[model samples]
Target chain A: SQKIEQNSEALNIQEGKTATLTCNYTNYSPAYLQWYRQDPGRGPVFLLLIRENEKEKRKERLKVTFDTTLKQSLFHITASQPADSATYLCALDVGFQKLVFGTGTRLLVSP
Target chain B: GAGVSQTPSNKVTEKGKYVELRCDPISGHTALYWYRQSLGQGPEFLIYFQGTGAADDSGLPNDRFFAVRPEGSVSTLKIQRTERGDSAMYLCASSLASADTQYFGPGTRLTVL
Candidate 1:
């Protein structure tokens, strides 16, 4: 069975620090990998996407690295603020626009 | 310029009942998708529509779950004889084209007791 995993534990960080989240998957060769930010009781918001051929992608303070060989992707948020705190999910395009998402990692930034 | 929108932000129903959740995709968006998210888990894809036809529905858990995009703009997810296990947040999303960045709606939280 295909599976995606993230750190189930919440990550706590101080304001202005960098927070990193990891997503690992098994049995998938995706063409595109995307990151999303989700808040409580709301839907996920798109962040950034990195292709299998692209090693890295960035948008402002957010950066994502995809290593198809490792079947893992790392998401980094620089100068993190309290507002940046949320559950981050990594999704893989499983063909035909369908996305398979990881469980997600929660990040809490304290000011 | 509006994003995806879902109706009845929250719903509560008894077991064996039927319910319908609605989704209005962004204007001009040709692709619409439905996903269900459980506690402590990410959104799981349920189905997607291209125009007025169902492009893929393999993610649907069972025959009790069905979705339709009659006109390709608005969609409805109908669950028959809902069970307690059906409780979860149902999310709707849309994009200008297939494989495009999907913009999501706030989601409808379904509580089956």
Candidate 2:
């Protein structure tokens, strides 16, 4: 069975620093990998998407790096702020347009 | 533009009862999907619809769960003989197409007593 894994630990970082999150998957080659931000009592909001063939994608201060050979994707937020605190989810896009999501990592950025 | 929306933010039902959850996707979205999330776990895929047809129903746990997208817009997820184990937040999402980035709704929390 295919599996998606994210760090379960709550990451604590100070404002104005960089926060990095990891997403690892096994037994699947997804066409695209997506990242989302979810707050308490709310649904996930799409953040960024990186194609399988691509190595990196960037938008504003957020960057996503995909390395299919290693079956891992790294999400980085530069100059993080307290407002950026939330659970970050990584979803793999299986070939058939289906998504398999990771349990998610809770991020807390303090001032 | 407004995003996706779901009805009955919270629902409570007794075991063996039937319940229906509704999802209204963003206007003009052609793909709709259903997911269930248990506490401390990732959201699990339940079903997906392409237009008026169900393109994928493989993730549905059993025959008790069924969904329909009539007119390819509004969708309703009906559960029969609900069990205590079926209690979870039912999520709905829609996108331009199956492979596109999906926009999710707040979700309907189902509690089976």
The most accurate candidate by DockQ is: 1
Q: By DockQ thresholds, what CAPRI class is model 1?
A: high
CA shift of A82, model 2, Å:
0.8
lDDT of 1 at A58: 88
List, residue by residue over B38-112, the lDDT tens digit for candidate 1.
999999999989999999999899999999998889999999999999999999999978556898999999999
DockQ (0 to 1) for model 2: 0.84
lDDT of 2 at A58: 97
Q: Relative to the unseen true structure, what is the C-alpha lDDT of residue A13 in candidate 1, on a scale of 0 to 100? A: 100
> Against the hidden true structure, what lDDT does model 2 obtain?
0.94
- Per-candidate TM equals 0.98, 0.97
Q: What's model 1's lDDT at A67?
A: 96
